[model samples]
Target: MSAAFAHGLIVGKFYPPHAGHHHLIDTAAARCARVSVVVTASTAESIPLALRAAWLREAHPQAEVTIAPVVDDVEIDYADPEIWSAHVTVFRHALALAHGGAPEIDAVFSSEEYGPELAHRFGAAHVGVDPDRGRFPVSGTMVRRDPASCWRWLSPAVRGHLARRVAVVGAESSGTTTLARDLAAHYAARGGPWAATRWVPEYGRTYCEEKLALARRRAKATGLPKPWLDDLEWESPEFATIAERQLLWEDAAARTGSPLLVCDTDALSTSLWHERYLGVASAVHPRARHDLWIHTSVEDVPFEQDGWRDGEAVRHRMDARFREELALRGLPHLVVSGPPHARLERAVEAVDALITQGWAFAAPL
Candidate 1:
């Protein structure tokens, strides 16, 4: 079997790529040997054009398609030929850049009434895929209004961008990991989209374990005495590395997780940890944002050294520092103390309130 068309074209704002847009792109890819997906956004739109292009590329990695982005802030006026020409100019340039020059487009795929006009401008045939929106029943307009309602219709990349993130930060053995895991489980037990809920473990612990193991291996090779876990040294750059890796893992989880993502620790927490070990403030900064922060209190919690803990005294100082930094930054957070179950209960309530409040998106153009 051979593809019916040599080349196909798709152009849209793709404010936030949804399932419907993917279907249209898939439809074109099945019929054409090559497809060019042009993502055009106005300057007034909130979502970046580069981000839209990246999402499309991620969503259609296996498809034979080129995702191109171009910015156009021209006023729309369907009834005026001059405005239509201006819009076509932008589309043509996008396609040309994707191909290094304009390729003969044999088909234009869309789910809108303007499909025919778009194809005619490119001297190609119009292929409409579910123009009535009967299949996916979703739109950029609907998603922008309340993304949570249309959570199922979004791609993982888009979901990652919209998902609400909760970071649990605290001293060692303060039950941060326990609380994060419990919160994720509470949401996953819902058995719908929530079934995919995910929790990101603290990356710093893993980094430290690996660092200590490497040093021990080197010492053994040279006949030096095995160094204790607490003997591992910390460098300023290492904190930045840990923070960067933490965000990478968190982002990966958010992409596949439910609308609510729980992280055991975040980059902001790394900054505090740096100060605890180095006795000075760190230059490390967080690249990502957390919607809610849950500080696990060391009070009433017995500090159990898992071979990596810095003991009860250090734990208390770290816990106090965490609280102080959270307050100084004016970040939204709450402290959870007492037994594991009690801490879990309070964390769950805070998460419930966050989800219930809903997301507030900037108005789209």
Candidate 2:
């Protein structure tokens, strides 16, 4: 069948693209030979215009997605005819550039009431897709106000923006790693209304293991006793490096579209370890900010004498330190005790509560 229009235009701020936006674009693409989606943003906006454009391009590869340049000292409220006219001028210029000429728009596609006026200005027909929002039943305002609650309406890219970080942290042999993995698995299996879950393993553990291996290689060369983990003193520089690397990994995982990140350990825990061995807690490492913290209790979980681990006394001391530091810093955290399975349940409960409570804080640093 011949297409209804030679070229169709759809425009929105896409403040964070949701299902409704997708539906509008898909509807336009179906009726038109070619569709151009213009994503606009203002200086006051937090989400980048480039990011939103990229998301639209990825989400609808068949459509030509373009970013409308930010116009200074211009209001973006589309209800105002003056503001709407300014946007139309910008979008027309952008579309012309994208098409390499005065691009002819056959139709203007949108889910908003301004569609008719916009189309009339561009000398095109207005094609409204779900103006009542019966199809998607969501809006950008709804998603922005309570993302977790409106998660079902969000795209993976949007969910990435709304994802929450939950760090599982405590003293050694406190089941922090195991709990982190389990929590990730639980969320992944549950499989959103939100995006999938991601787990970040302890970078400090990997760092220590690599250092221990290097020490072993040196000992072998000298034909001497292999150095114990205790022989090497923890320094502020090493802890700082570990914290930096941990943050990097966490951020990388977060960008992968997972709405929930279960981190095995964060920088604050590393700071506690720094104090334990180095006798001073330097604030050089960036504080790992998490929406929720699960502090695993060391009492029920047996302290395995791993080659890298400090003994039971040190474990107890570190446990106390974690509590003291958390309290002093006024960070919110839940202490998960009991057996492994029970601890997992407690951690799950806490995470669910946070997700249900809805995102209120700013995106993770």
Candidate 3:
């Protein structure tokens, strides 16, 4: 069968692209030989224009995607003739850039009422996809108002916009890793308010392991004394680097927009480690305020001997340091102690209380 239109145009704010927007684009792509998706972002939009445009390009590779920036100072009133004319001019320029010329647009695709006027401006047919919205049963407004409730509708890129972070911290062998993983799994299974959850493992441990291995190899090659794990230095600069890298990893995980991000040993833990090992305070602290902080207790869990782990005495000292630092900083946190299962339950309870207390999901600034 022949395509109904030679070229079609789909335009929207796409503040955060959702499934319904995908349906409209996909429908247009199927019926048109060529499709151009214009993502117009105003300065007032919380999400960046480039990010939204990138989502459209990834979502519908078959369509040509472009971003149009609306100046922050301009008052947007589509009904006004002056405003409509200005937008039309911008759309024309964007479309021309996409096609490399003044390509003919035969159809205008949308799920909005303005499709007719837009189509008329281009002298094209208006093809409204799911105007009644019964098929997708979702809208940008609905998704924005309550992202957790509308998690199913959002794309991963947009999910990052609404995700709340939870950090799990404590001394070595304090069940921080296990509790973090369990908290993520618990949220994933529950599947509401936050449709999904992600966990970030301790990056410092991995970094130390890699560096120690390299140091040991160099010692053997040069016939120098074998480097002992105890000789590993924890300087203020190293702690600052670890904290920065940990935050980067957490932010990368957040891009998927999982309702919750469970991080094992965030930058705050690094600060405690720096103070304990080198007796120097961290120059850079974890600046991002997590929605919830779960401090695992070093008491019940037996300290496991690892290549890099300090002894039981060190664990006890570090645990005390964590408590002191947390208190001194006045950061609210829940201390979870006991066996793994019991600790998991307490952490879950704390998160539930937060949700019940109407914890707002404030995306990282």
Candidate 4:
């Protein structure tokens, strides 16, 4: 008999040992006498095998866990037994240690696709613990590449590390401005610090104007080809600045300690417009990163102009483009339904929905 197996072995990367991971280990240990956790990072980037081992060990001190480093031979074919066999030897050794590492182990627990395979290869009963059923596959690549934008997907420990506190964004005339004011007012009334506005239209104009002035100055100074380069680059400095401000709001949110750091508009609009106007579709962009997007429709509300405004034909076209933008960016946004006032209510509800969806909050900090 397989030593009357009762304890299990669990294996994973354990990148920050999030709750989901801790859950797997805990649940596995319950079923088995002891669950040996193997934190695998055969060729991890920068994060050393030793450090990864330490983190796993520290996180699950009570559990009978053994951390092992498996080195796969890269010189041969990716799927060759030569490569896998060597790694399997390391795995087998890890299992052997787990049997007597601290407590009695008898089973194998896994929440990944290859966990069962590993279990079968190692001669352990496989127990699947993924109750979430892949609803939200929060990948390491997405979190590392754009933490601010993808912060909601992170574990609480990682999310807390983010500098910017809160962000609100949405489609054009989507009540982003109204919603921002309402949210700030709500937060302020609740005895919290005030939030920062994303666009602050005046700032946008001023920023763009400054960029234009600089371009004028640069054109005068070096004379870098008029319409071709000078005006083209100078025309949308503000747009680029706003794009960078997307990242800035996070910092501004951190400093404020407010319940919500609302942005009237974010980089998505700026980037889209920059592409449309400045021919910067290929050039450098500031790149904004607002958290929540509220979609506003001007179906009933007249597309009124405040001088710095574009027409419905443009807004309509932009609206269609905005959907594409959201899809491309993997952002979750709520539509502010109804006429003017209805938009306001819908925006409030939509934001409230987003909060519920992400489990993100800091007790007004």
List the global CA lDDT of all models: 0.89, 0.80, 0.79, 0.54
Clashing pairs in 3: 159-257, 160-257
- Candidate whose lDDT is highest: 1
Model 2 over residues 1-365: C-alpha lDDT tens digits? 88899989887888778999999888888888888887767667777777887777778777444434333335657668888787788787767767767778899998888789999989999998999999788988877777766777777666656689998989989998899988888888876543367799999889999998998899999998989887775667888999999998887777674668889989888888788888888678685558888888897988897767888998998888888878887888988899989999988888888878875533311
- Distance from true position, residue 183, model 2, in Å? 3.4
Each model's RMSD to truth, in Å?
2.2, 5.1, 4.4, 13.4
Clash tally, candidates in order: 0, 0, 2, 13
lDDT of 3 at 340: 90
Candidate 1 vs 4: which has more lDDT: 1
For TM-score, candidate 3 versus 4, the one ahead is 3
Q: Pick the candidate with the highest TM-score.
A: 1
lDDT string for model 1 (74-168, tens) is: 78777788988999999989888888997889899999888899899889999999999999999998988878778899998999998899999
TM-score of model 3 vs. true structure: 0.77
Clashing pairs in 1: none
Return whichever of 1 and 4 wins on TM-score.
1
